[model samples]
Target: MDLVIKNGTIITATDTYKADIAVEDGKIIMIGKNITQTEGAKLVDASGKYVLPGAIDAHTHLEMPFGGTTSADSYEAGTRAAACGGVTTVFDFVIQRKGQGLIEAVEGRRTICDPQACVDYSFHTAITDLTPEILEEMKESVEYGVPSFKLFMVYKKEGLMVDDGVLAKALEKSKDIGALIAVHAENPDLIDMRIEKFLSEGKTSAWYHYLSRPEFVEAEANKRAIHWAKAFDAPLYIVHLANKEGLEEVTKARNEGYEIYAETCPQYLHFTNEVYKREDGRNFVCSPPIKGKESQEALWKGILNGSIQTVATDHCPFQSYEKDWGKDDFTKIPNGCMGIENLYPYMLSEANKGRISFNKVVEVCSTNVAKIFGCAPQKGTIAAGSDADIVIYDPNKKFVVSKENMHSDVDHTIWEGIELKGYPVMTFSRGKLVYKDGQFLGTPGHGQFIKCKGRK
Candidate 1:
């Protein structure tokens, strides 16, 4: 064995127990007590710490273009932030240009991050152009190990939205090809009308951005997308689902046996529309904007129950200056939040306080994301034969989140000033100690692209 983590409690999606984890050749080789550490091999005595699978943030938009500017986090900074937050892998979107094929989209995105990422990652290709050939390309991409496709029902003028016809055809094709279709569910026409109405009335504050994209906008599109998915008897995953109305729709469909997979982000759980009243409130501006206290409570429930399966950071970042674009016109502001570094502490803090179990945190943060995105057993769990991706969490440690402590290149963090009691003290990617005690030791490009396979 090359390394041993002794006397630590391991938490999985369903099990929690103390064991010594043994690793060799970047894979877990044994997990049992009394395994003596061999000479010349590194030994980490994780006494009284919790050793959990590294988080897999299933949603992120690093280096993506929006409006006239691009998201601030590049692959190097973003993945380093991920490792600092105990995330060993991420599934970033491979946004498609109108004329690009699936394979080309993947390769182009790889050119951006392949040499800089500090953690293993994969792509969920966004299907912006729907065509017969693209439909066949979905199958080819699946054969190439990316089995998830993202389609947008909004962003009409930006050339990203697909109509109902394209959505339906994509759903049917996903069914045929064994792929999952993830959608940004929003009633774009209704939102457009609302935006025009709000702008005409001079209601151009950041709050109006939320009003323009009301909860009903998400509910209606979710219902409509599920309608098409049911028509084809297909599986559908809703990305960044934010409220009770959308959760209810997913629950109703799931009650009828539809595979209504969904995820929610920490921003929606931690902040609310009231933040728009702050001077820098515009910084919290994101599509399907965060809602009220009631919505936050409901989303927490969704996490507790089985309705919300994963907790991913939609870690799309724009610096404070980029947000000034929307100062004059709310529509012009690029939407997103910087969240890659706060994912683990936020959830683990909640778990420590009885809001959720520690095991549940591992499930939503790592295991379920892996199973849903087809990276299971390989990355989400700490069993033998799995990649030696792990985190040594110190439940007794405490820290207040601040921009100074953050690793992302962005100038600020939305998670600022929030104090938490639990955090990852050491992050191990494969068998390498990548991050430790507020510093990153891993080199860029140490992370590799994970070829994600389809659900069988």
Candidate 2:
């Protein structure tokens, strides 16, 4: 045995049981009751603690470029933060900016991250154009193991927003290639109209950003995406779903047997649109900005009831100097916030407050993401023969979130000054200790690029 975690309550989506997990050569060799400790194995006393599979942040923007600036975290920094927070894997989006070939954008992003990441990583191509050439490249990219694609309905003038016909063509192509399509579901026309009206009225506050992109915008786009998915018989994933109405669309589509999946980010679950009312509200500006308090409650209900399938960080980081870039106009500001390191701590605080069960946290943050992104049974669960990616959690541990403790290059935390309970004490990637007790043990370029199985 290389390493053994003993005397912990192993929690999964389906079971909570006591067991000792043995790791040998980066694979889970055995998990059972009262396993004898091997002579030379490294041992961890997980007494009175919980062991869960490492979380997989399925949606994150590392080294992402937006609003004339790039996100502060490079692949190495972002993944390092992820490891410290107990996330062992990440599926970051490779942006295909307008006019660029999809393959070229993917390649460029790969070059930036290939030698930088510290944990297992994969990519989902953001499809900003659906030209015949780009769509053809989509099929080829799928063969290289990037099986998922994303389109934005809100970045109409800047990114991919197909009319009914283009959506049909893209979905049809995806069907033939066994790929999944994810959409940033916001109605751009409506948002632009409202934004123009607000600006004309001199209402350029950060709070107005939420008012301009209302829940109905997301709901309307979600319903349309669902219909398109059904029409083309293609599986679809809706990213960063913000409100109750959008969840209704996903639930209704699933009830009608459409292969539709939706993910909501941590900001939506914990913060409200009122966060934008602060003097420093610009720090919280993200696309589909945090909605009303009622919407936050509804999203939690959706998570508990199964309407929302995954909980991801949507970890887009920007520097504090850039946070005030929208002072003159909210629309001019970049839309994103930092959360790669806060995902687990924030979720655990929710659990401590009785908002969600501990097991449900693992389900949304770990299990469902793995299953949805085609890495299940290997990356998401603590079963035999699976990769030994694991985390030891201290539920009673408490810490205050501050910039000094964060691994991101960004200057401030969105949840700064917030107290948090329960954090990862140790993190392991494939039987190797990557993070432990506030120290990062992994080396640069140690993480391997994983080719995701195409969505079936």
Candidate 3:
């Protein structure tokens, strides 16, 4: 099949130019001035639009079970929503629950996603259990194309947090295999102690939860993780860093030439700890919960200064009814929020407000993510020979985020009622017109499993 997207201002992290992109057999065959179209080719009139590489959401949780309830969006619904929002790729986590082997956990998550996703996907194995056998399997798993591993520093008793020794050993192993170690940075002992104190004092609301695990807990953990990474000379990825202090730690590490990179989510950039005090504050409940206004502004500065490499949604979806699951006792609340479909729009809105540049938007949302994840130049830019994953975005369009317009199966939107300018009007995945103008045309199983190149 041949497709032509013409007359758009094509934006990449490096350059903006007027060009026509021609795709044939799911690859960019031509990209230049006034590319002539063949007979029977599909033509996309992209005049007055911005054509850029499709966004890549590096963090997402689909159908993940946490705190007694599963996230509402299955891989099918979540990736469909991602595609509709112009994200052509996702690097989702494969959970390693307690007592499950690392390989089994990887396979289980793969089973859930293999036949369902509508966009290309890759996996980052979450190592919640540290056993000799499981540790031994890490090299093999990395060999099998799952090159990055994540360990959490929270949920002490659950199948989430890893003790310091386990984390150290995992980092040592990852270094040997050249795999990246991603961390969910929070001081679990501090958080648990505070939570116990709060519960004993009869303070058990969503607001109390935010107070229990304060920004200091995250900041302390961030510094500690960086220390460990430096000690072992291990490459590290700090996921969903929510505060300024944490970004400062990341900046310090980068300045010292440490192989450390961090990602921040939209929740931290836009929402403050004040959300917890709202009547529906449980909707924003997440681990290392959003902090005060000062932190929010600092996080925006982190994005502008390049201390934070990428902006991901950390898209975790659950129903509003599940908000009760976190009621009365914040400890029972699941830790996540949904925003995969809103990522680019939110960043674009920031650009429209002059908070950031359009080139920076492409860098954070697409290019930088691809570079950190080892898919750079191939999936993150609209250059010749790259995958023809492109989006035609209308910068003047404005819309409010509501559950009624969302493509995910979740019953609530964390960003509901927020007005935003700019949206993707058309999305192409590897030369195929998968989403356009309120419709999805991709088939199931069209998404291929991408084998990521590990840390070099």
Residue 188 accuracy (lDDT) in model 1: 90
CA lDDT, every model vs. true structure: 0.91, 0.86, 0.87
Between 2 and 3, whose lDDT is larger?
Answer: 3
TM-score of each: 0.99, 0.96, 0.97
Write candidate 3's Cα lDDT for 1-456 as tens digits: 389999999999889899999998877878898889899999998999999899999999888877788888889899999988889999898888778877677777777788998998888889887889888888777777788899988876775888889889998988888788999999888888899899999998899989988889999999999999999989999999998888898999999998899999888888899999998888899877999998899888888898989999889877888877878888877878999999988887888778898889999999998888777677899887889999999988888888888788988898989998888888898888889876888876778787777775
lDDT of model number 2? 0.86
When summed lDDT is taken over every stretch of 10 residues in candidate 2, the lowest stretch is: 156-165
Candidate 3, poorest ten consecutive residues by summed lDDT = 447-456
Candidate 1 vs. true structure, TM-score = 0.99
- Clashing residue pairs in candidate 3 (N, C-alpha, C atoms within 3 angstroms): none
List candidate 2 stretches off by more than 4 Å.
97-103
lDDT tens digits by residue: candidate 1, 278-352: 778889999889988888899999889888999998999899998988886789888999888899889998898
Better of 1 and 3 by lDDT: 1
Model 1 lDDT, full chain set: 0.91
Q: Tens-digit lDDT track for model 2 on 1-456? A: 889899999988788999999999999999998888789999988998899899899999998877788888999999999998898998999877768877678778888788998989999988766777888988788888888998777677654565766777778888898888898888888999999999999999998898999788888998898888998888899999998888888898888888888899888987888888899899999988899888888889989998888989888878877878888789877889888788877886788778888889999898998887888888988999998999998888887889888876788888888888777889999999999888899977877787878775
Better of 1 and 3 by TM-score: 1
